[model samples]
Target: MTTSFPDPAAFVGKVAFISGAASGIGAATAGRLARLGARLVLADRDAERLAAFAAQLATQDVLALNVDVTSMASVEQAIAAGIAHFGGLDLAVNSAGIDLPRCATAHYPAEDWDKVIAVNLTGVFNAVRNQIPAMLARGGGSIVNVSSIMGFRAFAGQPAYTAAKHGVIGLTKAAALDHAAQGVRINAVAPGFIETPLLAHLSEEKKQEAAMLHPVARLGQPDEITSVILFLLSDAASFVTGACYEVDGGYLAR
Candidate 1:
């Protein structure tokens, strides 16, 4: 049998910027986008892991930058490096985020809340702040922000995570609207209970419980979310904007 699907590697001349590229969905998406022919600017605070991943990619032009997304100066420098390496950005994915361990609202430390907001919400803003101008310079581009299913549903003991994710949705929609006229398209992916390093800390019983929350009865893989992200960043989805594609295995439906 033969396949007629468009070759994923059609992005040969394009450039993409990805935050949180050190692990999980961010790493998976970076690999996927590279396989699809996009040159990459990979960013994360973990210098060791980031370099290791960059070295493994098939894309040789990969530029690895250690970025603390919470810091505006760090973000600006990363963007400068990206433009220097790839010329200009064609796509950007804001996947740098963190979640506090399950804790009751009353006991949720202000510090933890601040950390989550800084990395998950403000981090995304910092990505957009830097990449938008480069995309605009070239006429237009695409952006994918990683939100969470928790943004749309209530889960006990995750006040900070939920609030930060909700803010991501608002930001995605606002960016989509503001830049659509300028040929830029922005969207988000809201994933649920994926099997990633972030979730590896949970006990077997807790992991099973989390998996059962989704209608599919299994946790999602990072590739599952990456596939959708690649599509949104591709020309195939030029008409789609201000949308949040849920890769939650029907978790939101249950």
Candidate 2:
């Protein structure tokens, strides 16, 4: 028996940039695109991990950058360097994010809130702003930002995470409309809790509790979110823009 995958020719000669590529959904998306024939620029704050992961890819056509998304200069430089290396940019996945320790809204630490918003919200802004010009230069391109189910729903003890994700959806929509006519299509993926490093610290019992929160009764895998991200970044979704696709397993339905 054979397992089939999407046609790789669709991504031939394409160049892709992915932040947070050291692990989880970002790594999954990078791996998928690499397999689909796209040259990659992989970015993460973890230099060691990013380098190791890039080395393990099937292709040598990978540029791994250690980037702190919270820094605009760092993101801009990475994109510039990637374009210089790959000739141009055709696709991007902005998945870099961080969560604050759970706390009440009134008791949330100002510094932690700042850090979360910096990495989760401002970091995405930095990536998008830096990437748009490069994409526009190539005539047009596709971008997928990783939001969360919390973007639309309220979660206790996660005020910072919730707000940043909500901002990402709004930013995705606005950026999409602004560049839609110019040929650049921007969309967002709102994923449910997945088996990512972010959730690795949770106890096994807590993990199961989270899974049961969804109708599917199981946690989503990183590849599951990556699949939707690939669709949004592919020509198959040519007409898609300003849209936030929920990749949740019926979590939002109830």
**Top TM-score hit:** 2
lDDT of 2: 0.93
Per-residue C-alpha lDDT of model 2 across residues 1-254, encoded as one tens digit per residue: 32234656878779999999999999999998888788999999999999999998988899999999999999999999999998999999999998767999999899999999999999999999988999999999999999999999989999999999999999999999999999999999999999999998899999999999989999999999998898888878888899999989999998
Query: TM-scores, in order shown?
Result: 0.96, 0.97
lDDT of 1 by residue, 204-225 (tens): 9999999999899999999999
Worst 10-residue lDDT window, candidate 2: 1-10
| Angstrom error at residue 240, model 1 | 0.6
Candidate 2: list runs displaced more than 4 Å: 1-5
Worst lDDT run of 10 residues, candidate 1, spans 1-10
Tell me how candidate 1 scores on lDDT: 0.90
Candidate 2 Cα RMSD (Å): 3.1
